[model samples]
Target: MAKKKVSKTIDDINRKIKEGKVVVVTADEMVGIVKKNGAEKAAQEVDVVTTGTFSPMCSSGAFINFGHTKPGIKASRTWLNDVPAYAGLAAVDCYMGATEPREDDPLNGVHPGQFKYGGGHVLHDLIAGKKVELRATSYGTDCYPETQVKKKITLSDLPYAMMLNPRNAYQNYNCAINLTKKTIYTYMGILKPNGGNANYATAGELSPLFNDPYYRTIGLGTRIFLGGAKGHVIAPGTQHNPNAERHENGIPLTPSGTLMVSGDMKEMDPRWVVGVSMLGYGCSLAVGLGIPIPILDAEMAEYTGVSD
Candidate 1:
């Protein structure tokens, strides 16, 4: 059998955007609206659905290229705010992963891996317009002869600052609750022992993938709001499971379709991109993303109506 498709096209959605007629609603708000008005009516009335999520995403980072200094050197080593940045790409180019730790951090000491300062913190500081010390050691080349360089720089000073998150935006995630007697520290926030309190990430009804459920509108190159900046879905994220059990409404019962998103780091706001420190565990970055779904047809409308 041939597959049924959404009648909406990218051009149709663009026209709505141009006219500012694109109807947008949080995932949570759509639930109430869908309940009050049937999916058929709601589909006709609504034009777009916007969803957002803020959670500790470990697979987040940035690739920065600091403009070469006078008497340029091939940077063999680089450090951002005392945290080692991978500078093996090219001279003055480096990638800072979210979980990279501070070398001087008291890992086994008093605070035991409590990252007071790290790559995430540095990125946060950069976004916050704070000056971060940049240090590099290089093997001097005749064409680009310089050995050592030390400078203080901000995000504004860099020629290229791009947020390159490898894996993010899980379609559906799980709520964590510790069954052990002892308290557990996890990426899903601190899990209380004996189910004292359950912690669930994602915006629930306000999550992007939760609203779409299926990969109809949201697919490769779909424009999205990432880190408070415009970004696009590049590919399926790591462990992108599409064949999960689904409810009658098409919403997945398990975690499904993830997204690999990227955007300009400079355009990101500090509010949406933040450094996070898990109490007992290592550090992570809290990333916020929002996607606008156009109501092209009844199917799109029905998809948006699926609630928490």
Candidate 2:
């Protein structure tokens, strides 16, 4: 006997969503469906699987265009609350990284393990609607005459503010533990002496890419929940290694793929995007994100059905 094939398109799923007939379930729920009804039968009943995660994502940042200043100074250097922002683009346009440390920051000076402020905090302040001191300088040019500008700015002050992260949502990562006799501080969080504790970054069963292990349903233009706002996948994330060795079940054993996600920073919720300075690992943003996988076939259903 031949096996039955199941398939559906995104448009078909959208039409179902509009008609209030789409069968949506969390990735965790799909596990039971595949185990009981089998992937083929589960695919016939389920339409989409949703995945979510929240963790420290260092490669996150924002790009802001602060509308041309009077006298139009082409900003060659920029800083926000002592944190440097890359002003390599046009006048008044800059990019601030979440992990970039600030000048006079104790972490860079007297302090070695504890940090207080960074670009991530600056971003958080803006999202919280707090006005931050903005300082800019430029070598007066023929086209852009002003040499400098200083002022307080908020999210609403900028012409455009985009949360353009270069790399995020790592597919899978390491579980760290200290084998030595001494305590150590790491990005995965503080590890106790002699393997007394362990830390891992992934959300296990609720992670996004782990569900669509083969990238069948997620690609460029796929809509997602980013920092509490609706965002889209613009391109393959940085360090996206599709050929990484995988288990027989398709789960990668190492830190493999990553995503370069973007969305409007203005629309993001402050709660969903948090700034943090680790004990020894410096600074980064705790980003919240989610992706919905369309179970177009039995194969996709089987993949999403895998649990932690």
Candidate 3:
């Protein structure tokens, strides 16, 4: 008796098949095929990696029917766990209320009695120049400590201005803040302060705080991402207030603060799904691998179609 060796070539295996030519493989075998296909090749290929760092800590909301003329809409933070951070948010379909229809309707039987559409134009209008309060805790401080230090520190008067730099994947836009009035206005323009001029004396000039190298030393707006129970506190409700609790240890202090920061967040807009998809697919092919593609802008635009 002699030992037999199996050949690995596709042609050698095909010759052994029966007349019907049916070949079944195991689960592990199929998995190996998938892994092999997914592996990156060294051949010269265009790599389309998403640029810039991504953050998932920020909160987002939406408004609809902004003006009275248009319908009102609502905005909320988008939850995209399965989608990559660089891929951005997803868009959803919206609709408006129904009205009485005319007797003579075209495509009579084919169409429904009434049509549906999205809402929230009024909500958008109401959000303009509106103040949003965000509360975050500094590390090494217990939120419910007793005998806490209480101070009414004016952030704007701290000899520097604070600016929020959102990811560039979304459209770059300008926002105006009236700290005295606690109002913020968003618009499309250069993000530079002082009305985008060379000099910095104007009301809208970039805050000098950001330029100072020593700003981080005094713990000015520095934040650490805390995971699970001990992390920063993000109270869901609209009210932004900080309260102290009595405990066995010495007085624990927690500070309550508000940010007058504003910027154009259209970069996180769901309408850009189509563009993301096209880029993802193109990049995947260029790299000779099946990369996970994000939803495209066209797809979202289709979902959030014009309101009638």
Candidate 4:
């Protein structure tokens, strides 16, 4: 069978956005709407659909530049609340990785570091208006005379704090199943033994890529709701698989188009961005994101109408 062709355009979507007539629906809400009103009527009435998900993504972190201290110090080593922050980029600039294990993790010997307080937790603390310890050391350069510095700082003290996540939302992913008799720990959360339970990722119909499965509306510059703040899709995320198998509606049935998203960490709320521990796996961040899919035409509405 021939592949289905999508026919929505940007200009048409923009017009709806301008007119304030866009219809937005969440994934959990789409199935009922489609069944009640039918795809045709639902599509014609809806101009935009809002999809959202809160999932743990490990490949996420933030880069922050704490303005130089008096006399300046080329920060060579740094730690935040005892969790190491990468300080090799430049003086006073550090990248706090989301999954960097806690140095003094109580569970170090028993399992992978509990990751109870990693970069993501630091970010959450910073966003919640809490103070954190900032420690750094330098080799004492002539240009930057200061060698060592230790101070308590808040997120407000930094001039720039940006979350540059390598990967965020996935277009679609598989449901994890464990074939072994024992429970398995994985990035997709815990899996039970031998069909005891199936863990599925994605927000079902309420996911951004699921709504625009073929990358029709989602691309560079598309505005998205990231980690409790407004963000944008900068590029295709790492391991983007656009050629995956698809359903009749063109939504890929396998892991597909992912997004490289970024936003100002300063504007984020602690509620939507959180640090999580996967028992035996490791630490990660559960990020919440929402995207508005514009229903540009009948075809676009039909796409939005898909459920389950």
Best by lDDT: 2
Model 4 segments more than 4 A misplaced: 1-22, 36-40, 106-108
Q: Rank the candidates by lDDT, best first.
A: 2, 1, 4, 3
Give per-model TM-scores. Answer: 0.91, 0.95, 0.15, 0.90
TM value for model 4 = 0.90
Q: Of the candidates shown, which would achieve the greatest TM-score relative to the real structure?
A: 2
Where model 3 places Cα greater than 4 Å from the true spot, the runs are: 1-53, 62-65, 70-260, 266-308
List the lowest-lDDT window of 10 residues for candidate 1.
107-116
- Residue-level lDDT tens digits of model 3 in 153-173: 222212221112211111111
Clashing pairs in 1: none
lDDT of 3 at 305: 18
Q: What is candidate 2's TM-score against the reference?
A: 0.95
Task: Report lDDT (Cα) of residue 34, candidate 2.
Answer: 96
Candidate 4: worst-modelled 10 consecutive residues by lDDT: 3-12
Point out the higher-scoring one by TM-score: 1 or 3.
1
Using lDDT as the yardstick, the better of models 1 and 3 is: 1
> Per-residue CA lDDT of candidate 2, range 59-94, in tens?
999998888988899999999998999999988899
